[model samples]
Target chain A: MKAFISKNKWTLLLLIAATALMLVLAQKTYYALIIALFGIYAIVATSLDVLFGYTGQISLGHAGLFAIGAYSSALLTIKFGVPSLLSLVLGSAITALIGALIAIPASKLVKHFLSLLMIAFGQIIYLIINSWTEVTGGSLGIMNIPYLNVFGFEVNSNLKGAIVIWVILAIVLLVKHRIIRSRVGNAFIAIRENTVAARGLGIDVQKYKVLAFAVSAAMTGLAGGLYAFLRGFISPETFNGTQSVLFMTMLLFGGITTLAGPVIGAIVLLLFKEVFQTFSTYQGLIYALFMLLVLFFFPNGIIGLYKSGKTAVMKLLSKRAEATRNGGAENAEN
Target chain B: MLKIDHVSMVFGGLTANNDVCAEVHKGEIFGLIGPNGAGKTTLFNVISGFYKPTAGKVIFNGEEIQGKLSNQIAQKGIARTYQNINLFKKMTVLENVLVGCHTQTRANIFDAIFNTKRSRAEHEEAIRRCREVLEFMGIGHLEDSLAGSLPYGDQRRLEIARALVSNPKLLLLDEPAAGMNLTEKDILTDTILKIRDLGYTVLIVEHNMKLVMKVCDRICVLNHGNKLAEGTPEEIQNNPDVIKAYLGGAK
Candidate 1:
């Protein structure tokens, strides 16, 4: 129990903090909705980190994958009369399959070519959703998507949605943490740091790259499925290139390769955007400037900044302790 | 255990290795030595499956392995270090070695996600093996430190440790003694011999003649991408062609 707590202290603390925030904002329906939205976006950012941060691959087409999940789930529930939970699973699984297919070609390419391919992929998906008026409802997306039902209880309220989303997010984060510390996660990092060395050491780089893509897509797809249920609607506009870029931005802003980075990044950036909605025209400019500033100052992201700050404080404390010890020795000699 | 049969690697008008042929018998320390631009590293690349040879075959344990992917070749029990230290710098030394254990362990995504008993056991076993290898390389205490933070010699040893953890049949060391002091070189020589004593074949490429002569049971010389000499160290040392190639003339 002691070892478990020590290992999971941060996770425990985050859960407590989230629960407290939920209680404090219990009466504010708008804030609760925003928090729920943050949970969804945070899931996307964390999924992106699995590829971009750990595996050192880029995908600007995540918005497309997200759209696939949302549409599939919404359509399944509305048209096929499938249960909400089953649709969510099926939708994410479909996204995972598509992600693996994309990775087959993407894994063979490197750097700029990979990024360009992803951009084209996103554009293609967006175009399909935009023009396919028959099934996707075209620009006019499907509405009144059913809310998630758990054991016959309807998650219709924002508070209940937030609870469900956070629970899922917590599980995602825990699973990610386990994988990162495991042998499989090591292979991902090995590919990221040095592909040649990784290959020489017997790691199947191509296979792992595809695995990273599939896993990342599955998580992002889950987020999209949850988003559709929470908002009761999702349009192609919500999963455009700009939205994809926003997910990347959140990952970068929070810091990549760290679990806390994505959640903090999603919550902070979403809140910031909400606050700046009054100046809607300049919101993009303001966001860009803020990202630039953060990148310039903290290249590793906010978590990195916190880490370095912590080390600095620890260093100062150690130095003070050493100085006091030396002074005491001198007084004894006197 | 390994044969380089008429291997020739040509890169767009430049012959990095021309008709290079050599054989490494199992459990012996084989050395490939030459001056700069002599294609020693290129030949290592060919053997390790980094570059498919323009011509010829690389046979290991009686099976031809040319043109195969590097990871496939590695899975066939051939591990190699780089001329330049290639380590996952940001990762801890233990993590770096654990990656080398990838082929040995087999817990899939489902196992990792669910934290199954098999995954936990495999993980613990991998860690134990990594620790054992680090201890062998004399870096057991530094396992928690980042690979990038180690001193130059330790980084080199860490690379060797990473390679060794994979439990390859043939170990290739590229300039293992490069950038090392005389004492470190002596230690490396001992380590190489010890590795050989453990029934593993070693193929080394080095510029340090003294260490090569001291450690290698046999040496092959390359000049201008062609084989100049292949013999016991004493035979290579006495050969006029080898001396002329090294000194640019027979003195």
Candidate 2:
């Protein structure tokens, strides 16, 4: 426990500091709204990391999953009068089922083809939303989503709403941390590293691939439900291919390889957009520029860059130590 | 414990394995030797469930497993190493072995997310078993190192350790002595024999006759995807047909 704590102290410290910052920002509900938005994106991106980073699957269709959650939650509350929490769970489940179904056929393709398939799925979902006027309210989308009532604790203000969203995000992050060291995590990484080798070890590769889809979609769906309720409105335009690309960008920019990569990525990109809102007309160009820069400089993501920096510094120090030992000692590993 | 009855694997027009028949009995080190393009690796693929056989049956422990997925076959107490060293390159040596324990573990998604007692127990048990396997394979100190960074011989040992962690009833080693020096081959020969002592039925494929002749209890020679001959190593060394196809008339 001592060694584990020492090794991960920075991560734990960053986590606590982020929480404190969130609480301080909660004082201004307007700021809380943006924070809540950041939290929501973090949830979505973190789930995407589970697919892209650990499982080596890519889905540009996540925005479709996001839309499904939003519409299901809104429809359930508006049309069926279901409780907000129950509807959220049901919405997530429906999204997961859809994701699993899509994964079956999608998994047959290789590399960029799989991503293209996801993009196609996202387009199909957007088209459905646009054409299915009776259910989806067409391009105008559903409006007046009810505020959450968590056991009668009304989340009517941005402060309460932001707190709830961040709380969910924190729980999701913790859950991800736990899962990344567990058996299921190993299987996911194994499949990512080598599918043939994973199969040789007795892992049901297809089943696990579907499971990654279901889990990723389920989380993205939950974030969507929260987004719908928080904003009290959602549109088909918001869940388009562009939005899916934005989500993937956030994951890549922050660091897909680390536990905090998606969270940091989401927060950075979301805040970056907000800060440059005056140039919102050039948002796509800005995103593309940022993506190209990151790709050129930090292909492994920001966390990956930091890891490389650390290694270089450690190597320098170790070489100095070796010099003192008459240059006979073996170089350090790790 | 493994019987392949006329297993034939065809890749479009190419028959990689054609009507190969062999039985690997329990408590023996059975070696499959052949020259290049002789389908020794294809037969391993057939038994390990990588390629679906176009023709006949693979019976293991009296259970038919011809049409099963590779993972399904692995779950039925069969583990295998590759001809190419296919370790999870970025993962730690310990992690590589732990992944091999996937089939034996019982933790589900809920267990993982919640860090349930059942999950923790299984995880700890798997770690313990992985460590033991690493030690047995004589690479215990490399547990924290990345698998790809290990020396070639240690990497090979790590692969074996990973396979051994599953407590497989049958282990298939494809060219275990490939690229190894004479001393390394000698140690690998000892290790294969020791693994057999642990009650595992080992079916090894190798081009190196010195190691095969030293370790394998029985030998099956393959040529052009066909089982050419099966006999003891002494019998195989003297057999003119085996010598012609693989040994190139060498004594």
Candidate 3:
């Protein structure tokens, strides 16, 4: 509806402008290489947003889905000689199936229990990747994973890869934005508010819960499919519990409730990671501290801060104008 | 349109509701009344499909829906409000009502993603219908305000608006006038009548006698999880058991 978009005009503008700026800036050498990876992570973070921000559920084992997607996509293409696009599709499908499987139990469990289930799921995937040596190459990881090619054109180069990834991000982001503005989005919010009330209003809470989780996993899996092609390698270490936490941190740092929050959060945190890889050992500690500070002061994330600032500025301007108008009116009456 | 036959709810060893039975015919405002802890709300939950009765059948429009999921019952054209307002606090009042439009609208993930013409039309219809409901409930101007930020009366009205937008065949109100003053109560009575006029069968559980007596076409009295009496408001007023149950002694 126009009302939905009209209300979110500023946010939509900011995201579109930022996205355009990022796509243009992402063509250079150092920028393109890492920014492509950032784009991949952005997709993952947004998917997590659908769970945590919209659905009011948490998945600490999303890294498991990510790993499954990456390994499946790469192995299918490299070993089974499956074509690239089909393998990617298959990977996403398998990840969605796994997501639904986890969701069956995960939907019935509340915050802590659900988180624990996902964490255990992530660890199980890690174990599988570690033990299934002949198939997965175990810790050695999959190598020579093909670059993304469509119809015969290679998009493996850094700039091309960045373009490819951002295109997917653009489409996915728009779709997510539209959904968050529609009936299903409101139903998701209703489920988040009060499950009993949502059900009384005729919303199937459990079904929507699983839907959120599955959609989140599907998004992360799509990113994983892209990541496999972009990096040309796969390892258990890349998708793990730590990575899942980072994804959540990204969602929180950007303002989880906002549509653009996860994407912006991903960009900001990923940029920091690339710029400060020299402190890679301390990244986890830094992330925790940053999240702590965000939780304490800006629980709504950067968007909240921006909104508050805008409100203050508008108030100040209005007050000053009123003061001058009153002064002029008094003088005129005198 | 609703029949509750020998419905009872037991939580562990505690019987929250004993065998309770009542019938709400089409095109009437049915009132459910009782003192505190009398299982009025428990009956509402059983009918709304929130709780599975320990023993009984809840037949709605000829379908046995005792153990069906709450949303399924809602989809069967039954919608209800809570004793405590269960609005989505952060969403706009309009958005809250749009959520009630979930069953009537069909926009799959692809439609949402692509912003298809059909989905867009549906979205517009949802907003338009939400506005109409808000106006009907006397809160059209509060559409953009967050549900949590509205005045107390507005919030209650907003809840009704949300319930009505779903086109419910049976709309159940849990203490719809719990915190209203004289004027708000009058307005609520009028609104309930209007809802009935629009072909909705309303069932209300309330402790507010003034509004209930003014609005309800038939009143069912419950005391200690059991039906004490059922009749028109004047007849209910003369019922000795209801007076004894409410005042702790008969006149």
**Candidate 3 error regions (>4 Å):** A1-28
- Write candidate 1's Cα lDDT for A88-176 as tens digits: 99999999999999999999998889989998999999998888999998888888898988779799999889889988999999989
The C-alpha TM-scores of every prediction are 0.97, 0.94, 0.94
- For residue A206, model 2's alpha carbon misses the true position, in angstroms, by 0.7
lDDT of 2 by residue, B1-251 (tens): 89999899898998888888899999899999888998889888888888888999999989999878899999999999999999999899999999999989989899999899888988999999999999999999889999989999999999999999999999999998888999998989899989988888999998888899989999998888888999999999898898788547656
DockQ in order: 0.86, 0.84, 0.74
lDDT of 2 by residue, A1-334 (tens): 9999899999889888978988897799889999999999999999999989899998888999999988898899999999998888888898999999999988777689999999999999999999999999998888888998888987898989888998899888888888888899899999999889999999998888999899899889999899988989989988988789889999999888577789888989999988998997787788898789789999978888888999999999999987877645443421
Q: Highest DockQ: which candidate?
A: 1
TM-score of 2: 0.94
Q: What is the C-alpha lDDT profile of model 1 across B45-101, one tens digit per residue?
A: 998999999999999999999999999999999999998999999999999999999
TM-score of chain A of each: 0.95, 0.91, 0.92
- Pairs that collide in candidate 2 are none
A173-290: candidate 3 lDDT, tens digit per residue: 8878877777778778888887887888778888888888878888888899999988898888897677888888888888887766787789888888878989988877978987
**Predicted complex 3: CAPRI docking category:** medium
State each model's C-alpha RMSD to the native: 1.7, 3.7, 2.5
Best by lDDT: 1
**Model 1 misses residue B183 by how many Å?**
0.6
Using lDDT, rank the candidates from best to worst.
1, 2, 3
